[model samples]
Target: MINFKIRYTLLLFAACISLQACKKAWQDHTAITIEALNKTLIQQINETPDLSTFSTYLVKTGYDKVLASSKSYTVWAPTNTAMQTIDAAILADTAKLRLFVANHISYQEYFTTAPNPSLVIRTLSGKNIIFTPATFEEAKIVKGNVYVKNGVLHTIDQASGTKQNAYEFMMSTGLSTKQRGFIQSLFHTEIDTSKGVKLYTDPITKKTIYQAGTTFPVTKNTYFQRVSDISSEDSLLTYIILSDVAYDAEKAKIGRYYNLSTSATKTDTLTQFAVVKDLVVNHVYTIDNLPDTLTTVSGVKIHLDRSAIIQTQKLSNGIAYVVSSIGYQILQNKIPVIYIQGELPDSVRVPSTLSIRTKKDLNDVKYTDMQSRSITSSPDPLYYYRYKTTVNSAQYKVYWRAVNDIFTTSFNQKVDFSATRYYPKAVETPLATMGYKAVAVSDYSEVYLGLYTPANYGTLYTFLVSATGVVSTAPSALSLDYIKLVPVN
Candidate 1:
């Protein structure tokens, strides 16, 4: 038994020694692998013959010490030919040299593992670099997947500069209210508290009327801002701009009678949407597979007329093509519909009801604190809501809803819309319903308002009446819910 115990102790001692040796061998192998991979960015650049020129730039800029330190970074080391093309003036200027080198280095490594990828990387210089991925046919990713102690390295044919894109160029120049108001109708009118009332003499009646303030608050559109953002990488876009002279000429031709500088009023004839659509909707072009004819983000078609491409800019992600003029075809039958809410600033209501309701929700009538409108705690006698709106179109239709209530019998009278010459109607209906019904008020199937070409932005007035053929104001009780405007050819 003692002999067997001694043999077992010796066997256990040998096994322990063998285990230590195996552990040491594995540790040595790991150390060798780590040593092989451990190389600083500067050291790697020094070792490569093609990167000799870039290394000199790094040394001149004193960025070598930055890479030697234990900080992670992705270096897009320029090839020898690219470095040779660097301007001598950049090398002479210390600040410019630092900026140029800093632009090439990113904070983290990005390997070419994904297909057709795009990423916005921030460099040491704090400038954003948009890295666009390409296929093998476009440019081979030379010397990729280089793992160093700090980060990774990838070589490319060319590096992009911080140039503004097509949309950015336009925004930097500034946009006009006339240019922006087409998409958002609310911008058409602005409030000026300084001017209370300006008296204007009526030519035919020799009567004086009051005009309210005309200043509007400054605002921006998010849709256009995003479209012009340089960091947007989801899709490439091509923007075409009309020069100042061309824009003014087109504006004059379209708004010859309409005064776009002053406030839009019923008396002024304005070709509202037609000119704006012709200018903005047709100017933009999107690039997909580089087609000859491309559609805009707003769904307007644009022909890639080579003769029309007067100016062109090569942006990092897209192109900016400037055209001399836009081909605008005025389709008389295909005009867009315009809706004006009763709550707009230009609208006025008299003997106003205590409650107001939106077309969105007819059942709920809530109290509102809107400008240029009279408010009451209870429904007032001779209650009428009269609003005058300017239209670019020559024809429009007004739609209103009649709601019934417990006092339905008291509201037995017809809600006449065209009792005044201001609102002409082709179809008229009596307002004697205890329920809800829409009434279309117009003189013709396509009602004609004043035209801007011959007149001023065609001025039109819409009013509510409690009785038929009742001119002037009469003692009455009625509810004026809402009014909607639809354009016609």
Candidate 2:
């Protein structure tokens, strides 16, 4: 009985020890599994042998900390073999290396099972990468959807080479020198108050005043704001870089309207801006899909001569074509028609006596017309509607719409042009011998005025004179709706 009792006691002790050992093993296994689930993107990359090269680059660029952060990111890590193909020069330069690594990482997590078939994602380097289910840009995705604590990681078969954007391409020296210099010269800096902390509120103006030294300087280019933003990766654009010869030729054709100043420098600057303003179109047209003509964002139609292409560069945000010749029609695209509203004249003679009547025309379009309220019999009472504007040194055909609905008697009117505001000394002959006679009844149609050529490109004063010496009521009074000056090339 003693032997049996001792054996039972030993068996019970052994079973308790075995149960304790199994419990400890299960606890350790759970701890390791939880640790693997908590691994970050950087940790995952560092552990993978195939992505060791990319992991080394991330450490060199100090982007490993960025990946380890709490913010979500998607990393397209290149395999060890793929990293070998990268340019040595890029790795040598810190800026290039940083940019190259940033190009592979994006802000948000991306997965292979995304709803969209393809996406143009802006990377941390400010460049766009084309992401599809099967590829990252030109690189084939070897492994994807490897989720980490903060983001997802994907292994790529090859590394995508960094390409310059449209704006960056223009910044390159020795390429489109004139256009690049002009664009660079437009760069200026302004204080960004939003980046600074508020110092106090102004009591007088009720405006928040930011701390003077706290504000950061922001670089701005007028071309980017007024024209296309070629630096942006959100939209694709087609940029045309004109060669020096083509630029000069196009500038000369469009310089007539911009010849407001006598200074050659001022005229050249204005002409240059006008010439380059319409060069960027808001669409990407590859060489194979390029159309015969491209309409610019500013609505100028330009004929594209494929033969004139000096070089074509595929950019990250867009494509650029360096062309030696681009043709623009002077009359159709360069010069626009000028419309002068009679009610909004620069200066009018006898303002108190003139009446501005607002009415609707046959097309139910609302319009305002100017009419003379003078009822004097004085000969040539100086009852004239004068207007001032800048004009090119070109011939123009004038047309006017003067509705005579309130007038019972038909009256005559004529137009005169001069460089100065003084009366007489006509630049060109008046329309007709008796001038234009208004219809006795209602007439909403425009009357044709004879062609008048300006002597030079400067401010011009036009006088719309009424018939001399006539007592006038609403009828027989001078009336004008608007005038149109159509440029004749």
Candidate 3:
């Protein structure tokens, strides 16, 4: 009986030890499971002692629910000390506070070990924030890559300040008031057909008709629609805003080209738009990397003088320079060469009497040229091919290429200019003294016609007239390939 009691006591001791070990294992497993469930981004921010201010603002902005949801996000949480520097005006306004908070969060979970050295992250506020392993914008990351259940969190030393884009900067700055006002004047409202409500179908035309007032009016800017959209944060642009004195000076130079005898108001508006149109370039160029010459979106080349810059603003979207003056020459870059093809004339004296021939030249380059057909009559019929274009008030040097490949004999042609489209009663003076005389047979070279200055800045009519009106059955006719007018100051 004594031996049986000893064995039973030893078994009881072993059983108690196993029970204690099992309880300890169960407690460890429960702790791990609870930690895994509670370590979401919102919870992680709430638990961090230094991130209390950031956590509070997230809840106030209703972004706490967003971080707690399944969608991934990266939060650059500023410490309480960093939050102390925030503007009191931002906290007073709900919309401003929400925007300020949203600026710190982005859509994706970006870790510090990302392959890219830097990334342009689009934040929840719709503005872009630059992110690097060590920093977010100007704010230094104190503790980074804090992984959570939903996203990653990085503690920052300072809050990332919001910046205005190029368009916004121009509107807010007092120096750019003239440019801002001009751009604002281009705003107009148009009916948005996509938002219209369908009423009924027309029985006769079998078309759907929408309610008259169902569609809303959406405001649009002509400069934004037609030119580069500087307001968009997705693109980068370099905008130059001239001071009021410089603006008036630049307007005076470009005003001569847009001179209208009809309306003074229309002339002023055209001059203002032209001045503003060539000021915005597509790429962002800082003063350090700026080239000596930059081309505008309107295809005008402008000389960049660093000394002329009064203020330089580093915006979120791009850079803006307030300049005292812009260097733009009138003739060199503003006026472009005008080209007119012989076969594509606006009107011909007799369409049936002209033949457009396509042939290869001496260089084996294929080209199309217009040739006069057989006209057997007295006072040899003069064939006229008229071309029209708008010219600035500048002298133009005329050039023409008349390839005489079909006929063995050479032919002659002259050019005449007029303000009206219809044939003038008296033929104006010829462009060249010799009238592009005797275009050699089979010679495919451009002949220079002397310079001619237009009387005014408006629509110009160019008439290519046959120099010698020879009525013959043989192919001794005037032939031309193209005409070019190069502007001279």
Distance from true location, Cα of 333 in model 3, Å: 0.7
User: Which runs of model 1 end up more than 4 angstroms from their true locations?
Assistant: 1-37, 69-71, 87-96, 115-117, 120-139, 159-162, 167-237, 243-245, 257-307, 328-336, 341-382, 386-489
Q: Which residue pairs clash in candidate 2?
A: none
Task: Give candidate 1's total backbone clashes.
Answer: 14
Off by over 4 Å in 3: 1-38, 113-117, 192-216, 341-388, 416-438, 454-481
User: Which ranges of candidate 2 are over 4 A from the true structure?
Assistant: 1-37, 113-117, 188-220, 233-235, 342-390, 414-440, 455-481
lDDT of each: 0.50, 0.79, 0.80
Point out the higher-scoring one by lDDT: 1 or 3.
Answer: 3
Lowest summed lDDT window (length 10), candidate 2: 425-434
Number of the predicted model whose TM-score against the real structure is largest: 3
Cα lDDT tens digits, model 1, 295-360, are: 554444545566665666654345665566665332222233444343442333345434454333
Better candidate number, 1 or 2, judged by lDDT? 2
Instruction: Indicate the TM-score of model 2.
Output: 0.75
lDDT per residue as tens, model 3, 1-489:
999999999999999999999899545422222243448899988989999999999999999999999988989999999999999999889999998999999998787656278887889988888887678888987777777778888889998767788888989889867888999999999778797899999999997788988887899989988877888999878999899888888878888777776777877887898888888888989899999888999899997799999999887787899998998767747777788888988988753468898888889899998887443322333567888988876788888898776566765667878777765555543332225366688788888887877755678888877654352334345567988888886
